[model samples]
Structures are given as C-alpha cells and as structure tokens.
Target chain A: MEKIIGFYPGCSLEGTAREYNESVFSLAKLFNIKLEPVPDWNCCGATAAHNISKKLSLSLPARILSQAETAGMKSLLVPCAACYNRLMVTQHELFENEELKSEVEEIMGMGLNSPIRVLNVIQFIQEYIYPGLQEKLSSPFGKKVACYYGCLLIRPHDVLNFDRTEDPQTMDEAMKMIGAESIDWPFKTECCGAGFSVSRTDLVAKLSGKIIKDACDRGAEAIIVACPMCHSNLDMRRNTIDRLLGYKTEIPVLYITQAIGLACGLSVKQTGIQRHIVRVDWQRLNSCLPEKMIKEEEDIHG
Target chain B: MYYALYLITLLSKYMAKEIYQNNAPHTLNNDLFHEIGISSARCYQCGKCSAGCPMAEDMNYTPNTVMRIIQAEDRQMDLELLSSESIWLCASCEMCISRCPMQIDIPKIMDYLRQKSLQERLQDKAANKSIIPFHQSFLDMIRYTGRSYEVGLVLDFKLRSKKIMQDVDLVPKMLSHGKLPFLPDGIKGKKNIQAIFKRTLRKK
Candidate 1:
C-alpha cells in the first residue's frame, strides 16, 4: 500500500503555477505516493487576511486543517510556501491563545480537532522522496543552480521552525541530491516583493532583479525555487527584471519538482517546461544530461 | 524639609495628571500589546531591524523609526506611525523579528497597525495607494469563489485602483501559456467560507 498524504496546491498552483502542479504530480507518481487533495478545501486567505484581520487569518487555515482532519489525514503537503506559512502560523497562534482558538472555532463552525501535520514542499521531499531519490536518478542534472527559498518557507523561526532563517541549506541540499551544483549565492531568503507582484510590479522588478543579477553574477546557470510566487517573480517577471538591470539576464527559473523530474527521466512536457514565460534553454539543460537520455528526449520532443 | 517633600509630591502628581490626560498613546500601545502580545517598548533602538529591512529605503520611516515613534508614547507620534507608509510597505518578511536581539515581532505589529489605520480611516495618508486595494481585491475574490481567481483579482484591482492599462500586454502571453484561466474554480464550501467571513466581521 502506498502512503497517502493530503495535498493543498493553493490558488497559484492552479492558475499561474499550473506547471508546478503538473510537475509535483508527475514526480509523486514515480514514487507511488498518493497525494490526496483535501476535500472541499478553501483558500488559506494568503497575505490578505493577515493584513486585514487576524481572526480571518487564523480561521481560514483552521477550516482547512479541520477538513484534513475529517479526511483522516495525519499529514498535509502544502506546496505553496505562503499557504504553508499561513497554516503553520495559524496552528501555532491558536495553540498559544485559547480565546482566539474558540473564536476561530466559532467562525469555522467546527471544532479545531486533532492538529494535522503540515509539510512544505522541501520537508515533503526530504521525508518521502529524498530517501529513495538516489535509486531513481536516471541521469544527474549537472548544472549549477541557485536554490531560492524566498520568504515564508522559513521565517518567524519559533513558529515555522523548519530551516535557518538566513542562508537556508535545505533547498541547496535537495538540489545537490539531484546532481545539480547548488551555488553559494545571497538572496536565498530575500523577499521577492511577493504579494506586490500585481499591485507594485515595479517593486517586484527591483527586488527580484537584484536576486537574478546576483545569481547570474555568481555564475549560476539556473535558479531553482519551491514557491510559485518566487517562480513568477523570477520567471514571469523576467522582462521587468531585465529592464531594471538594463540588460537581459536569460537565466530560466525551474521549480524543484521540475528539476528533479528531469533527473528522474521525465519528459520536458511532463514537467511542464514549455509553460514558462522565460524560454528554458533546452540545449543547455540537455547538454548536462547523459548522451543516451538526451538522444531519447530529442527523438520524443523534437 | 517637610515643605520640600510636600512640593515634590505636588510636582509628581501634576506630571502624572498631564500624562494621563494624553491617553491616546497608551491606548495605541495597550491595544497593540493586548491584541498581539508584542510591546513596541521592547525595541531598544538597536537599528538592527532597520538595517536588515529590505524596504527601509522605500519606506517613509524606517522600521526602527516606527519603533521609536511607538516607544515615545505620544499621541502625535502614534498618529504618525499609523498613517505612515512604512506599515503599508512592509512585506512581512520577518527579517527584523528573526534578527532582533529582543525578538520583537515587527511584522505582526505591522499587520495590526495596517488594520488600525484602515479602521480609523487613516489609509488616505498612506503614500503607497495600491497595496490596500490589491489586498481587498484578493480577499474579495476568495470571499466570492472560495479561491483566488487571478483574472477576477486583476480586474477588480484595476477597477479599484483605476490603473486599467497596467499589465495589459501580459494578458495575451499569460493566456497563451494557459497561466490565466478564464473561469475560477469555486469550491463547494463557498457558503461556509462566506459564513466565516461574516462571523469574523460581526465579531469585529
């Protein structure tokens, strides 16, 4: 029997980051792990609720956790860093304040029952995929990449308590396991002006441009990330980023799952590589793989 | 000596009366402490938070200055901090709290301050006008569809902010890549989500 974990892709994964959704499912299929979507799950409210109302922030996540608990799920995999942070922080806040918990319960119309364990993409990979990753690698992804953790994945240390706040190494370690040389670059945990992507694209351009420039200057071929928001800022906002830098920095951003999927012999389309706004340099990525795998991929994709 | 002691007591009582008369500062401070359990008084002007803040350069007042304003415990300073663009501009990256020697949760305080600013109708004083509208549009989408509809959110934001021409060029590209879905994927629990919103608002 395969292990089943509740999966919450969040809003971005369904829309702007559909490629992330495809890559995550494809990678999970290889491991035979069943990623069950939490039934009738609503939005985690993201940055909006917290900015507007504290009660809404706690209540939104509490409802999602309750749904997961009702489904008999002991663990949930929240791939989006923002959702993961909201869920984890909500649990911590509710546990610390009984008054708030009861108020949230009243709003949720359900008892905040057994706390479901929430896992981000990195933690999920570390637990289930990393253990069996070595045996499944068909070819090493021999490329230098910067692992961008962004914010929310590891901050408010006492609440999330997953990785180091500054210069996090978990994503780097995971990238190394898949045969990619993780570069030592600053801005691993920098804010990409996340929620400001739509409201203040200029700010996102400035902040994300610095991250891209640093990665390129440090000789990184690609920037790998786990968050869709970071992927959007680095990949979707490439034109703006380039405008800010006064030159084009054509470094493609790949999700961690997509990078690992390539190493595990998944096709480019399967990993949703073509969905990216910044055209991925297929020739360069192919050059890093084994010759036979490259031939096979070319025959199928070409 | 007896006369001197009487005069000292009179001076102390006068100062206490003057401080109590100006109750706005304590109300703001006490509200923050009671709501979030974080006191701005804990900030000791280390400037570490401001130094590490990514948005400090863009903000009207740096993170430390906002802390100092709250620490001053003056009515004028409280209004200044609340109306300042620093609160609205905070990305809530938690860099300050992570490195603070006193472990002050600046992001949480920013959230509280933003809510207070809106409640008091001090949002007009915010220099960065689009942030609040974006947040409102996002929540509105969730409240309606029980999920964030990107197309709806962008349209709603554009309507609210009246920046209609912004990002128009990216729509075709997004559509071609299937990044922007024409329709929102609504959850079956839409009614439940609305109820949650209503209940939270009623409490407020």
Candidate 2:
C-alpha cells in the first residue's frame, strides 16, 4: 500500500529551519512514503498565540486541521513538534468541549468534524518509516547521539499522549534502527528556553548549555532533535551557549530526519547537513557507511 | 471520608472569603475559572508543580503561589501574579498539570493571567518588558501573512521593542545559511486569517 500523509511544515521550516524541511522531504522520498502538503496551511500559534488570544490560538490550529480534512487527508504529518502539540491540543480541547468546537468552527469558517490524526516526525517515522528502515540503510551511522525531545513533544501526556512523558524512547528507538547509538541523558525532554532563542539568547544559553553539556558528558558525539525550536536553541545559539560554558563544545545538532537520511546513504549535501551553524564532522560519520556507498556519495557530492 | 471532604471544602471557602475581605475590593466572579475552565482551588498547595517547573527559579512566585493567589480571589494578589515575570516565563511545558494529583491545569491558569495582563495593559508594570512587544510582533506577523515570516518578525520585534541590536550579529550568519529570508511569503488564504482575527475580537 502506498502510504500518503499530509505534511504541515509550519513556519519554522519555511524560515529558520529550511534544513529540517529539506531533510524531511528527502527522507520521505527515500522511504517511499508519499507526502501531500496541506494547502495554504497557516501558523500553529506556537508559544505566542495563547498569550494574545486563546480563541486565536485554538482557531489557528483548528483551521489547519480543517484544511487537512478538506484536502482528503486522514493523517497529517507535522514535522515540527510545536505545531504537532498545537494541533493535538486543539483536537483534545474540542473533543472535550462541543461548545468550544462550534465556536472555533464558526470563527475559522470551517468545520473540523472529520477526524484527522496528527503525528509528529518521530511518530511518523516510528509508524511508517521504521518498518523498512533496516533494508534501506547502506551505513551503520554508529555515532552516539543524544535524543532531545525538548518541551512540547511529549509533555502534558494526556493531550499529546504519543509517548512516555518523562522518558520518551521513540526517537532513541528510531536512531537505533539507523545504526546510531543513542545515549541516555537527563535533558532529553528538558526545556531549552525555546522561543527565547531570538529574544533572550542569554536564557537559551543557560538552558541549552545544560542540555549540551549533559550530552557531551555522556559521551555523545551529536544531539538529535525533532523540534526546530530546539535545533535553533541548540545549534544556532551555540556561541552564546559556548560563551556561558567558558569552553568550546563542538557537538552538532541534527534533525532526526537528517540523521536517518544520512544513514540511508543520502548525501550530506542532500540532507542539508552543511547548513548547521555548529559544523558537523560528516567525514567521520561517512566512514561508518559501507565503502561502496561512501564512494557513491563522494562521486555524487564531489 | 465524605464528611472530611465537605469540611475541607467549607474551610477553603471560608479562608477564601477572609482573604478577599483583607485585599482590594473586586468582585471575584468565576471569570478566571470560566476562562481556563479549570479550578485553581483544586490545587492543594502541592509544590510538585514548582519542583518540576524548569523556570521556577526565575519566577518570583512559584507555580503553586500563583495558583493560591487565583484561588484566594485577592485582587492585589492577582495583580502581582499577573505582573510577575513568572507568568511570562512559563514555556507552557505542562509539567504541572500532568503531575497534578487533582488534575488541575495550572498552565492554562497562567495563560489566563498572562492574557488578562495584556488586556489590562499591565505589561509595562511587569518585570519582563521584553516579551510584551515580541508577543505583539508575533501576532502582527500572523495577522499579515497567516503565518510567521522570520525576517519580518525579527525586524518588527526589534523595531517595536527598541532592542535593535538584539541578535543583530546573527543576521549575516542566518542569511548565509538561508535561515532568514529577506522577503515574507503569504498564504493564499490570508483573507481568511484576517477574518479569523476579526471574529476572535467580536467573540471576545
């Protein structure tokens, strides 16, 4: 069966996290998974909308879900964890309150009666992509990675309810299938001072510093993430994090899709690995791939 | 067990009434509860929420204290909680509500306080002035493009907050990596987004 899921790249993927967007598309193609982007999807309200207006926060994500339904997609793949949380939370709130549902539908001028399943990137891989990942892999990535869930992916377990809230293993499990050794770390689900990546780099420095330090102390070579917010805090704000650490930390943060793509013999350039601020040592990771696959990658990338 | 539960409820009401009398005179309708649809009075002063909060150290009042203030219905206390940096600092991590024995949604309550603070124009009086303008810029970006435009959001936030140099150094680096696009893109259904905003106001 050809599995097709609606994709909502969200705003971060369009702007700050285009690398994430590129890798997700490439990985989906590699897995033979078909993705149809939801037409003209709006923002998911992220961390700001609720502060402005609760109705807008609910209505914005509700509109996206309705759009997915109208597009004839029963399952929507939201790669950004924040967007997934917003969509899932809106559904949970609406299901519990018919009054709020009607109000949201009226406000957005759309009906959300058709059930749409919202899956985060990790869950999408675990369900559809994981089954055939081993046969597709041309390399055993073999790098010790710290799987970071940041704040939203699994918290408030009742609403998001995809994995264990305190100790999520889905990302780790996926990494293992790609031949990367995932490390057990304390900061897996810790807050990396998300939106503060831009507004308050100092706060991000302090929070993300702890997460990076823990990953390094545990002997991980790189950090794996599903949220663009976490990637920005961990990768883009590295200078602040390093400044606060009083030493340089060279741990590269890779979106899980990029990591999976690399293990599946996707070119580093194809996976957007070079776009990261903290430069990833792709040469070291490439040696873990099958020799023929490495030659092929060199031929293609060179 | 039933008798004890009833007694505890009565005691809480009496305690709340006593606190209301000593504070500023404002009728405590069920507005906060109605807005959040969760009762803070259900919180039994458990420090679990505070213990699990990643930003609790930065908060002047812990999550439990904020809940107590709302439960007491003290106008002065409510204002203090609303104006504190803590409410703005919450990442909405939802650790509190998930761990709450009473299943109280403390994050929702904090969101309500933040909303009330913004509505009442208390941001200038609050400890964190940085988030106020950023929030406005974010909403403005959404209202314009039906989604966030990163470069536009940064420019608008910097201009509005007057923190022009905030992360200015990262602009060139971001541009080099294609992180910051100079042009903003709009969804085709932007008019529908504008309609959503307009309807939200009338509903409010």
Across all candidates, the chain A TM-score values are: 0.93, 0.92
Write model 2 residue lDDT over B99-120, tens digit each, in one string. 7888887888777878887777
**How high is the CA lDDT of each candidate model?**
0.87, 0.83
Cα RMSD for candidates in order: 6.8, 8.3
**Model 1 Cα lDDT, one tens digit per residue, A1-302:** 68889998899998999999999999999988999999998899999899988889889999999988888889999999999999999999888888888888988898876678999999999999988899999989998998999988999899999889887999899889988899997789889999899888988999998898888777788899999999998888988888777766678899999999999999999999999998899466424333455578789999
Q: Following a full C-alpha superposition, what root-mean-square deviation does model 1 have from the true structure?
A: 6.8
Superposed Cα deviation of residue A70, candidate 2 (Å): 0.9
What is the CAPRI rating of model 1's predicted complex? medium
* lDDT of each residue in B1-204, candidate 1, tens digit only: 999999999999999998887844455777877777788888889899999888888988898998887777778878877877778889988899999999988898888899898788687444346998899889889888999988999999999888999999888899999999877558899999999989775433
User: Per-candidate DockQ versus the true complex?
Assistant: 0.73, 0.59
Colliding pairs, model 1: none
DockQ of 2: 0.59
Error (Å) of candidate 2 at residue B182 is 3.0
lDDT digits (tens) for residues A1-302 of candidate 2? 66788999999998889999999999898888889999999998888888778999999999999999888998899999899989988999897899989999999999987668888898888888888988888988888899999888897888887788778899998889888889988888888998766666677799899998788767688899999999998888988888888767778899999999988999988899988998897456423233455578789999
Write down the lDDT that model 1 would get: 0.87
Index of the highest-DockQ prediction: 1
TM-score of each: 0.91, 0.89
